[model samples]
Target: MIHKLLTREQIEKGYIRFLEKNPLALMKVNNRSQQIEIILGKKLSNIQYIETANILVEYAETIGIDSFEYLLLYAVESVEERQKIILLRDELTKHDYSVNKYTGNA
Candidate 1:
């Protein structure tokens, strides 16, 4: 878990550094390449204002839930989006152990 809260700039910088070391992670997500370009401040493609919602979702599911809250607070700008992330993070943390699956309607 991340102990200290990171500012937006710090979070972006860290993400960029991470991508530099693990470039394949970014290459795998080809659909929204513009978002990555916007964050990097390069004039690769002119796209709408980008947000971290997709990245947050992907990371939270594939990485670790412990860092979800921190990532949401640092990367997400919309209050509504942050609220959704918080709720999802809480649910995942609460159910971190159980692996029950639904068989059918009962």
Candidate 2:
């Protein structure tokens, strides 16, 4: 067995790269208000959004399901925010595992 530990920068960069891939299916732009609304399609919250692309979940673990949503709720766009997002994701993941170690949705 082999395991590769990833650095914080590597993880952060991976998240940034995922966002660059345009995983979102739809986003409505309100030109009048200069706002963008995510079309979760059928999924409810940002957590549900991870279902669309399970592999991408970690990137949003610290924050929501994507960069745009993270920016929206957190109202920030910077490395500091990314760090916070990553921290949040790890905490949530840990909590979830402790509660439901078996039969996890993943």
Candidate 3:
């Protein structure tokens, strides 16, 4: 089930993390955020990285998922804060794969 979860910006951070790991996604999540800021002509907090993962987990039960462990796994790999922009390609691609497969469209 789909829950009203993860804002595009947060998902973008996940995409960013995925990119850093894969280095081939070419999906510029940071750029996307920047462009969004430019389009709105306003600045937004950079808390999207930390916030999104938490938000996804908070609402996880509603979505019939255990936790945001899949996403959290990368972000909290070593008990140290990591840059969210680093994994835009790989992890996000996996998430996309999961989505596609879940929908039986893969």
By TM-score, who's the top model here? Answer: 1
Clashing pairs in 1: none
Q: Give all candidates' CA lDDT scores.
A: 0.51, 0.42, 0.49
Ranked by lDDT, the better of candidates 1 and 3 is 1
lDDT of 3 by residue, 1-106 (tens): 1122334654565535744664422334345556667777655445334334444455455566555434544434443332342244346767889999999989
In terms of lDDT, the poorest run of 10 residues in model 2 is: 28-37
Q: What is the lDDT of residue 66 in candidate 3?
A: 51
lDDT of 1 by residue, 1-106 (tens): 2223345565675455444444554554444666557577755433211333345456666765745564554456677867875676567655553433333322
Report the number of backbone clashes for model 3. 15
Considering TM-score, which of the candidate structures 1 and 3 is the better prediction for this target? 1
Candidate 2 residue lDDT tens string, 1-106: 0012234445444444554554452221112112212433432433333332343544467554664343323233467765775666667668778778666754
- Model 1 RMSD to the real structure? 10.6
Candidate 2 achieves a global lDDT of: 0.42
Local lDDT at 97 for model 3: 95
TM-score of each: 0.35, 0.29, 0.31
- Candidate with top lDDT is 1
